[model samples]
Target: MLARLSTDNRTAFMSGVRDYSPMLMAILSWGLVTGIAMSKSVLTVPQALGMSVLVYAGSSQLAVLPLMAAKLPIWTVLLTASMINVRFAIFSAGLAPHFSYLPFRRRLLLGYFNGDVVYLLFQKKAFATGYVPGKEAYFWGMALSAWAAWQVSSIAGILLASVFPDDWGLALAGTLALVPLIVSAVVGRSVLAAVSVAGLVALVAIDLPYRLALPLAVLAAIGAGSVVDVIADRADLRRIRTARPAAGTADPTGRTGRTGRADLGKES
Candidate 1:
């Protein structure tokens, strides 16, 4: 009995680890970047460490840190963080369908750990397949790995920042770390289009005061992509209607293509 319990525990832990490898890599890179940035910035080592553990949102953290460095007001810092993270509301909505089947406790836990990469991966797979097995386990796996790596690396960065030369460009490491996740989230044309638009807008608006331009760029990109998608959807429906045979129309091959005949053949 003891042996069986031990085996079960090992299997569960191993499963979590196996599923978490990719997330771990991302978190490590992100942590290193955040650590280096924090140490180099005006924030002290303790504050940086605290932010790494408490915030857990990379983009938001990066944004808030700069504001802090600039000696921005607390209200501005909080508002900027909120705006940058508003996308999570959409993420939450997307996960609602899947969460419907889970218990309240599990759903709450999933909400806490559901970042862009993990949520996108799970969303893409969930839509492709009817459902995912071990989704909760996978969520926990990624979350635990990300959380642990982020904390450790950020702390390491604080400790090592002074030792490493300023030329090391630790922030670049975090940016590079984000590439895999961004690439993975690239799904259909609409999503690609939105990303492209966002990039252009951000570049153009980089000089905006108080980072207002950043959020504006994001909104602009989303708007542009959404307009294109709506147009495409309408065009597609028009094409579909034109191609569809009219009611009571007969096929060219002397076969009745009515609902009855179509049902008999089971081809449609």
Candidate 2:
């Protein structure tokens, strides 16, 4: 399938694969943990497999599993899942400018493949370059690699859940695997603020019913980040204004009034 792509696109695609390779272990660990959890839950093996294949969202699946096990109403489960996945809306918005020019079906497929790690990596690597050729190919490379790793590990976990002892602490391993990724993404003050706020909010609301804390943390983080961004923008605007010469007060030859008058006196 990749052979159909132009040489530049193929190169970009492979570069994406290489860049995303480092995260595959983390993805595998999380997928395995999620699959094991689903298997051990009230869901039957078929249901667990189905979810792993179809939903393809470990976080949303994990968030909604308990509700499902408790026989919650369908609407409640759907609502909780939607709220938990609300960040995807933001991710989609970030991605739209890059991929919106594609055919509708292609765009829909791309959305299905989008994930937290993929979005982050794409933003860091390709977003600044804007909507250029080979960007989509690069995205597909990372997306396909991640999807494959997840599905393979998840399926293995479902099949081998009984073989792996609970004492192995795989869940902790999975969580630890994500720490590096999170730390790497905290590159600026806004991201730092968002992360800190989200962590605090999640802890504070941990005991909320129906896993409400997750959505609360997400929203709080976005708000905090946005506030920080607005402040930074305003500060930048003020600095720019302060640096500019007052209108009609200075000569157009890059000279201030005092400097221009001094030059005039010297010329005289």
Candidate 2: RMSD to truth: 3.4
Clash pairs for candidate 2: none
lDDT of 1 by residue, 217-258 (tens): 768878978988998999999999999888877667666668
lDDT of each candidate versus the true structure? 0.73, 0.89
Against the true structure, what is each candidate's TM-score?
Answer: 0.76, 0.89
Runs in model 1 with CA error above 4 Å?
1-20, 101-108, 127-133, 248-268
lDDT of 2 by residue, 145-226 (tens): 9999999999998988998887888767878887898899898889999999999999999988766898899899999999
Highest TM-score scorer? 2
By summed lDDT, the worst window of 10 consecutive residues in model 2 runs over 125-134
Q: lDDT, candidate 2, residue 139?
A: 93
